[model samples]
Target chain A: MEKKVLLGNEAIARGAYEAGCHVATAYPGTPSTEILETIARDYREIRSQWSPNEKVALEVAAGASVSGGRALAAMKHVGLNVAADPLFTFSYTGVNGGFVIVNADDPSAWSSQNEQDNRHLARAAKVPMIEPSNPQEAKDFTKLAFDLSEEFDRPVIVRITTRIAHSQGIVELGERQEVPVKPFVRNPQKFVMLPAHARPRHVFIEEQHKKLKEYSNRSPLNRIEWGNKKRGIITDSVAYQYVKETCPDDSVLKIGMVWPMPDDVIREFAAGVEKLYVVEELDPFIEDYVKALGIPCTGKEIIPICFELTPDIVDRALNGKIKGGAYPKYETNPVPPRPPALCAGCPHGFVFTVLKKLDLHVNGDIGCYTLAALPPYSAMHTQGCMGAGIGMHLGMEKAHGPEMARKSVAVIGDSTFVHSGITPLIDLVYNKGTGTVIIMDNRGTAMTGHQDHPGTGKTLSGEETHTLDLELLVKAIGVKRVVVTDPKNVEELERIVREEVAAPEPSVIISKRKCILIK
Target chain B: MKNVIFAGVGGQGVILASKILMEVAKNAGYDVKESEVHGMAQRGGSVDCNVRYGDRVYSPLIPREEADFIVSLEMLEVMRKLEYLAPGGRLIVNTEKVNPAPVQTGAMQYPPDLREWISKNVKNALFVDTSGMLKEVGTRKALNIVMLGILSRDLEFTREQWESAIKSLVKEKFLDMNIKAFNLGREYN
Candidate 1:
């Protein structure tokens, strides 16, 4: 085995290669974007591509899995929300070949809108979830995830927080195992999820969970460490690393396979110790499960569940004090904050400057353009999730009148426009409402490290492909007037926006400019 | 165990410096774990990296007041990460202030007498005057490599190891310039 210091995301990609995954797909979102990028760049064995959005990514991977090939779809926690439709049903219609989805969560909203706990989603869907503590487990557990998914014939979710996804450590690398793909047979009862077929498969899934729960109890993923019998701590994922370093003397159960609770193992460990505590981050997922098992465990009550846990924070929670005396760093002067800003030559800033001048209530979508909402150009007023701007603009127009459309405008990125913006734009047109939507056609997903989108005319692997025509597509949606212009020409953009908002019909302004950061 | 932080603005080459440090640490048979902020938070923001090295490192994150060294590429960045410096920890700073967006826009003023604050508060601080050195290098980006050179003095690593690490991580065309910057950084300490 070769030893190398690899990031947690790189380890997952390494595991994907070693497990002989056939298809890899994703929509770039940090702390998880590198997983698909690594596969596309280094591993030629796997056919990897970027889908328009998370839903398309999951569907692409799902298609590969049902056709008897191991597949992987990795995304941030919010991206999972986009793919939840497939995730729920894929549990009932189990996999012919192994399928794993890496849900990378951001605690403290580091690069996300919310630090949502996705382990609950795994429990809700009755799908088994695996989490790794470090780069080493990030590799091993990801390899194990594919096997567990195949064993239970279900799509597995490997949940990871930003800490685990971004941290780099020494990992012992192993060779790739070219596992043969299972043959697809004519079995609609198992593969197809119509109401008639899905009902019994639901029962089949319930029975499988019973067997999976039994396996969870005995699975090597969940291990118990015997230390002092006085204080017992139950934890999973990166939090397990903190618990181990903070309270080495305490008896602890490290839950690697996060879902199913590993009931028998949990009960066995709980019976061996006193003053049991569950240590986790963001949410009390394991704590809630342990309590429902009728086991008295203290969690979230004392241990704060706000952000990621460090060793000292874990010690302070577990032992009622810092490991060492906490030294107060500063006394009088407060350090000024250094917030992120758009690049010096950013095209988005120019458009937002015009909007600020026009005094339009801009509804901004996610991307580098979101920075326009900040100082120097406080143009954007309301902001929401991906593709939320267009619909919210429509809602405003509907409640108010055509005057509202003239007063306000919706702004979206090219990647997000395809992600979820199209349907909403169609909704605006079909409802006979007038709302001016600005599509910042940067030709790449700039916010998440410039990954290729459908509009970029390139696949995830850097292969040339058909570029989706944004202006034509909007016109086809029955948008009466569409104008394509450059934000660099600031005066004309201002004139165009003023003209479009005044028109009674729905109008689309495609501010086409290549991202400056992209070479 | 050694915990070092490279703090600077986003475009200041802090990430590349941290990577080179990790490479040097690994070359000296030390296990290294480096973690840095990415995504939306790092777009020309206060970017800092936590790099820990030892026989067997457990936590990639350094708790407050545990950093052995804090190498900064800009003047104000050192002040921002002062809390992470361990007692008697050595600080290597580039005595150059790249204005943050708010500062540049005149909403906030750049702290005056930053050098005075460093001298009064820090027991051992090496303020690297990269003005002339940056001129020779013909770019401000190589300042990170220069800061890395000063940091290399405090850590237990050989010159050959440093040279090899820089050579391996850096591009072929820019190797000579980065090596010159590294050597110029060593001339101070």
Candidate 2:
């Protein structure tokens, strides 16, 4: 076994590469973006790109898979929400090639607007959700996930958290395999899951699930470690490590395969131990499933139902309150609290600071500038999702009246502007609203590890794509009042914001600056 | 040999400090493993990095109350992660404060007298005037690098090894300025 240190995301990418994945598509989101980035950069055999959105990414990957190639699609937890429309139906229409949909979950909202646990999606879609505890498991589980996908003729959700996605660990490397591409078996009855085809597949899915549960029980990924069998804890992902650290002596069942929990194994383990505690990040999926089987197990009751788990949290729950549970005390100085902020030289900082000075009611989109909604630069008014800024600004003008609405504007980053912001700008021009859209063009997708966007003239594989110029794009959208300003020039930004805020009709302002990452 | 946990909001360069430490330890020929959180590309959010060095490394994970060095780039984040430092561990902090969105929105309370709060809870701590150092260095952007310089003295790596690692990290254009920043940081302690 050749072991080399690799990022968790890179390891997953490597695993897919070595597994002979042929096509991979993803929409850039935190934790998940690097999976595609690494594949595009290092794995020449896989065709990869950042699709327009999560739904499109999954659809494209599905198409590739249907063509009898191993394919994968990736997105953040929220991105899955956007792709849910396709995901639910895709379960009915199984895959010809091994297809894996990667959901990189942000449990503690570390870099997300909201902390969403995606295990619910797997359960709702009736798809198996597999989570890896570390970089090694991340790679191994990915390979297993594809095999399960092909075996069941279904899509598998490879769920990962912030820690597993970003952490670096020594992983054993493997030689890339060469898999011959199979021709797509275009049987209308089998390929197309119409109500007629879906009924049998639906029944087939239930049978598949029963077999999957048995497979989950038999799989080596789900194993029981015997230390002390008195107090049992069943955990998965990073939480397994925490449980081991906190209660190393306890009989622990560390699950590498997270979802479609093995009920028989859990019942046997729960019966053997005096008390069992289920440990998982964000949700009580296993605990609830175990309890539903009439097995009394403690999970979210003793552990927090929110956020990621740590040794401290586990120690407090397992021992501190119950004697012999207190972790070793560490004396620390009570340092002051400091929150994150935009860099002093960050162009977005200046632009938002100017917007606050102008007292413009700025509708914000997602990006590093989301910080502008906080602190001294409290400029952003409403923030929902990407591209909502321009459309929301127009809606505000219609609701707040044309005269007062002239003070309304939408502030967004250039990469964000391309992601979903362009449609709203087109909507504004067509609907005729007295609103201004400020595009903070920071050359790079700064928040998601400085990956390039369509506007940056770079593709996911670093190949040049057709660069979408915001200026020309806005003009083409039929916006007449388009002005590009340097965000670093706070004075100019303030003046421009004021001018556009008082304008009689819809306008576009492009605040162009190179990102700090690029610099 | 000690495990250091760097905690701060995203964009505070907490990860960079850990990365620099990893570089120093690697250059010093000590076994080291550094783990950092990725995927916070949207806003200023919680971020942490773990740097461990010793005779041999088993896992990249850090346990509760096990960190020998606790670097607090942000105040609340420091308190949030203080439980990770082992007894007698050193706490290095930047005195400057930036509040989170919730605090600014009045949805959360901003802790008052951060140093005192930390001193009350933690046994040993060092406060470096990082904001002042950054201003004196003539670049607020260099605050993270400056803190690394201060950490350099506390690190186990030799001065030459540290310098060479830092030198190889950046372009030549900023080398002189960064050297000045590092020296200024070293002098702060």
By lDDT, the best candidate is 1
Evaluated on CA atoms against the true complex, candidate 1 attains a DockQ of 0.55
Q: What is the C-alpha lDDT of each candidate?
A: 0.87, 0.79
lDDT (tens digit, per residue) of candidate 1 on A357-430: 99999988998888888898888898889999999999999888888998899999999999999999999999
How close to the true structure is residue B58 of candidate 2, measured as C-alpha lDDT? 36
Tens digits of per-residue lDDT, candidate 2, A1-519, equal 666556778888988888789999988898778899889889989999888778889999989888899999989999898899889888878888889998989878877878888888998998888888777778888877778899988899998888788876557788887766779887776668788998887888888888888988888878888767779999988787677667868999877666788777777788888988888778788887888899888888888978877666787888773222123323343333345567558888888777777677888988888878877688888998777888888887777778756666788888788778878888888888878888889887887767777888988877878887789989998988899988878887787888887888778889898987684
For candidate 2 chain B, the 10 contiguous residues with the lowest summed lDDT are B37-46
- After TM-score superposition, what is the CA distance of residue A363 in candidate 2 from its true location, in Å? 1.4
Fraction of reference contacts reproduced per prediction?
A: 0.53, 0.29
lDDT of 2: 0.79
